[model samples]
Target chain A: MDLANTSLRQLASALHERRISSRELAQAYLGRIERLDGELGAFITVDPEKTLAQADAADARIARGQAGPLTGIPIAHKDIFCTQGWLTTCGSRMLSNFVSPYDAHVIEKFAGAGALILGKTNMDEFAMGSSNETSHFGPVKNPWNLAKVPGGSSGGSAAAVAARLAPAATATDTGGSIRQPAALCGVSGIKPTYGLVSRYGMIAYASSLDQGGVIAPSAEDLGLVLNAMVGFDARDSTSIDRPAEDYTATLGKPLKGLRIGLPREYFSGGVSSDVAQAIDAALEVYDRLGAERVEVSLPHSALSVPVYYVLAPAEASSNLSRYDGVRYGHRAAQYADLNDMYERSRAEGFGPEVKRRILTGTYVLSRGYYDAYYLQAQRVRRLIVNDFREAFEQCDVIMGPSSPTVAFGFGEKTGDPVQMYLSDIFTISVNLAGLPGLSIPAGFGAAGLPVGLQLIGNYFSEGRLLQAAHGYQQATDWHRQVPDMARA
Target chain B: MALTDTDLKRLARLARLRLEESEITGLQGQFAGILGLIDQLQAVDTRGIEPLSHALDLGLRLREDLVTETDQRARFQSVAPQVEEGLYLVPKVIE
Candidate 1:
């Protein structure tokens, strides 16, 4: 059997039945990553010594009957999360040589659950760009089409999972970082309600909107992982104090009487015909499954991209101020004075996209522009949130296309920053509203590329969203489809 | 909303990013594209809407004033480009 294609659940069962040892499974995946990742560029760091060591620990636990569901399950993480002793680059040259001294709350949670860390995946620099081209390491290739970009800032995570380099990977969404890539690469990914997962040691992007999530092959796999990833940590001031939940409990629940809201604005222009057709087809399957589709309105939806560009960059400018050639990260090798060191270090370490965002962010929050840009964007953000609140009153969950188009060729949208920003228009409003959103592979779009159907749930409604996605996956074979590179 | 070279340079200085003189002209065009997109926010009617910083309605969560973390200066500073006596070294500001 091809161990690479096995789901987390199937792997768990195989390990429990003594059919495969954790070390053996780890070896197989490590070998595949070693051979295939050269072309895919899905990982930034993968150490066989460390991977096997973690698997050996899991094997010992399995022998002692102490294995958890995720024990021995190999997974990669976006480099955005700080992992102790690993090069947590955040896909930037700024931290390329900097090894983290600690683990993020998400890393700790997964480790505590006995999940084996295979390696760190690449990402957009500081999670800034819509495409992974901003990564200093080089852009990650879409597993389906090598020339196409795996949608980003979590592109590497999406690519890794989609290519079966690992069963799943942890990703962060500040805008559509998680969901858009998951859609573009044909993987299931979720960005939980803000504060559902702690950002304690995760590198800051846009703090208020940034939420750590998972990218996996199927919604069931995501549910299995989210169970271990959620909960509050006092270390993160923004972490929510919500009770624990069995995120997998609602999976396979009957879809009867389920209210799936179709946002009229989402179906309007901006979404390509191929993507729209795929989403409509997925809705038809849901309708057959006994779910009700109701028309809803998110009037302020069109403003999401502009609002996100303003607010995310503004927060990023403040958060990134910490990287001023002191403490750690990149420092200028030569400088005339203190100010020169600060400026040179940032200019040298950051890529063009990162500098662009920092400049835009600075412009918005500047002395005279604050009210006209930053404050206005914030107020518009409130209107977007209110629109979602009103729409939720009419439906149980919102559904739409996850990205405006399927994965495009590298440099296709790079010339025009506005064109790049528009790619995320479908997925950004969910983040602006602080609602939990999931993207699941629905069907193939243009050029036989995969398309995703997005499900946006009210705050703390992750279980319901997973259940709805899971119900759809059971009736379809899309989630079961793997890219040719991953097939054998 | 049209960003001139002077405006771009000033913004870059405030952002603490040192862009080369040659790179500024190219950046000016890119910045113009982004600004043109975001400028649409100004046309939005937000008179009664309050600006939201956080997505949730909850206020700041406070904790007791107690020591929760132990010092790990050595471990934390291991990755620093330059360090002495646990202090991060940089071009002198005191002088």
Candidate 2:
């Protein structure tokens, strides 16, 4: 079997039928990572011994007729999730030497289902930046073009799945981290409703906005993995205690009479011509599949980027205060006193973008500016949420361009923080409103780079969103297009 | 909305980040641009709308006050920067 081309479902079937042992599957991916990842910079950690040991245990389970759907399946995890003995860097130097002593809820769930840890992928520092350039290890190069970045902070996971380094990867979305990268890498990803997935062990970025999700080759594959990922844990205060869901249950459902909302602000001159054309083409396919297009106005959309910059950083500043050269993470070599230790340790540990955000967050939350900046941003945040609620009244799912353009070259927008923040303009509002959103490869754009068509659904509408995306994937082959470099 | 050097220093101090003298000017420019962008929020009238903190409006869930966790202090402290005698070491605060 061509392991690289096989889907996650097909791999599960082969594993269950004993056609391919989990050990062999893990070794194949390990070999590929060894060969190709040197150029892609997608992974931060890979332990063959740990991987094989888990695979052997999985093989034992399958042999004993106790296998589950995810048993023996190798899945890559974004380094943000703390895996108990592995280095959980969160793409930052602060935690470079810190080994997690306990497993994150996501990791525990996957381990319980008998999944194998393929490796830990790279990401933006503390999940702060739009591009992977903020990563302390290095930027994850887009598999489609070596010079361009895979969008981040889930850049590594999206790039890995796009290159077939792993069938799927666990990722998190604070503001379009999963969808933007997935779109740029020509893969599929989903950020479920705010509290759908437990955030127990995941390192906090912006507690209000951060969410864990999955990046995979197809929307159908995302469903299978998300089934195991979504659950409640008392450890995470925001985790919703909803009944267990079968995320893949609606994958085979038809898209007849589905109302696909097209937010006018998303298409109103912000997106490049090529990306707009690709989204238009995808909409045509949806029309052919018996879905109706409805024009909706998210009038407060333009303010989302500004509001997000204020609120996300405010939350981040508070969340990041724990890294004070105190218990774990990086500590300065020399310090005059405790205050100096905190100041110098943070100065040395964080990258420019992280520092910039911390400062911005601090400025906004300061005494005089609190009412003007932080609180006002929160009030405006409600308007953005209400816009979505009103628009959803007219449609089942919203569709738009995931990013304004395709994968951009490294340093293209790095110098300007505002430009980089705008990269997530299309995906940020959903996070603010706590709605489910999915992005799938629609078609190729300028320079043959992939463009993604985003599908936004109301709260707890992941099943419908996946069904809509699966409908599009069934009619198109964009998600299957791999980069030429990975073919070798 | 532009921040002066003094303002920058104050923010850096509040955030507990030591900024080199040379990096201050560049950071100021970046901050000006970011603040200018977010200043757009000032134009919106959010007079009486309650600020939405949690997206789902979820209240804090109360739990039983019970000791559910065991002692893993050694394992947890293994990754600490400095540890001795089962305690994390930090610089002396009192002179």
Candidate 3:
């Protein structure tokens, strides 16, 4: 079997048929990670012993004829998710030395499905920045172009999947972390409706906005893994109590008379010509597949960025307050007093971007500015949410550019905070409105870098979104194009 | 509305972060840009609109007031930076 090109379904079939053992599959991925991760910086932790042990257990389960769809499948996880014994740093100095004593709900689910932990991939510190540059481990390089960033905070996961180091990796989306990185790295990712996936063990960034998702080679593969990832966990208060879903149930469904919403705001401007062209080409494929395009307006679309900056920071500040020196994170060696310890420990532990957001959050939620900033932003958030509600009424799924441009070089936007924030302009509103959004490789753009076409669906429409993206994937080979480096 | 040094200092204090003198000016400039972007929200008319603290409208789920957790204080505190005798050590607060 060609490991690099094999889909999750194919891998499962191969494993069940005894063509490849689980241990061999895990070893193969670990070997690729060992050879390529040094240049890619995609992984933060990799333990061959732990991986083989899990693989061996999976082999035992398979021998007993108890294999599930994801059993023995090797999967990488974003370091943000707490794995029982793995180092779960959300790519920060704060929790750099902290090992999780328990598994996150998502981690537990994957383990229950008999998936081996490929490794812990790196991420932006506390999921704060657009580029993986904010990660303490170092920025994950784009597989297509070494100097370019794999868009973050899930950059490591996207890079890992893009380079075929792992078939699929768990990721999270807060203002497009998963979709942006997936787009930049030329892979597929989906952020399910908020609360569809439990956030119990995922390290908190912006609690209201953060939702776990996956990055993989195709939308179909995403469905196979998401089936195991999404479910109600009583531990997470916000988790939706719903019946199990077959995320792959709608794959290969015909798109006849499907209404694709073209948000006039997203297509108006700011998008690079190369990206715009790629999206247009993708739309043509959908149009030929018997889908109808409808122009819809998200009148408050421009306000999404401003509103997200306020609410996310405000929530982040509150969520990150848990990182006081009293707990498991980093603490200052010497301090004059308790207050000094708190201040110095936080200062030493957090990176510049994390500190910046915390400060921004603090200022917004502080006295005298609470009603004006935090409350006002929340009110505006309602409007952004309403915009999607009104738009989705006239369409089945919304399509647009995931990022304004293709993957940019490291340090390109890191200097300007607003510029970096705008990198997620096309994606943040989806989170604000609590919708499922998917990004699939449409084609390549400037310098032959990949461009992603985003498909946004109403709440709990992951199945439909996957079906639509799968329809496009069936008609095109963009999702199959691998980088030369990955082939090496 | 650019933030003054006094404003930055107050925010740092509230955030429990210690900022160096050299980093203050750069942070101020960056904050100015970020806040300027955030300031755009002030122009939107949101009269009578209820604030949304969460994406979903679900109420907090209530479970029976029973302890579902096992006593794993040792396992929990194993990763603490400073721990002794089942307690996390911090700088003394008492006078």
Q: Using DockQ as the measure, which candidate wins?
A: 2
Clashing pairs in 3: none
* TM-score of each model, paired residue for residue: 0.99, 0.99, 0.99
Question: After best superposition, candidate 2 residue A299: deviation in angstroms?
Answer: 0.4
Tens-digit lDDT track for model 2 on A223-259?
9999989999999989999899888899878999999
Residue A288's lDDT within candidate 2 is: 98
In candidate 3, stretches whose alpha carbon ends up further than 4 angstroms from where it belongs are none
lDDT of 3 by residue, A396-446 (tens): 999999999999998998889999999999999999988999999999999
lDDT of 2: 0.94
Considering the true interface contacts (CA pairs under 8 Å between chains A and B), give the fraction that model 1 also has. 0.90
Clashing pairs in 1: none
- Model 1: residues with Cα > 4 Å off, grouped in runs: none
- Model 1: per-residue Cα lDDT over A73-112, one tens digit each: 9889999999999999999999999899999999999999
Score chain B of each candidate by TM-score: 0.90, 0.94, 0.92
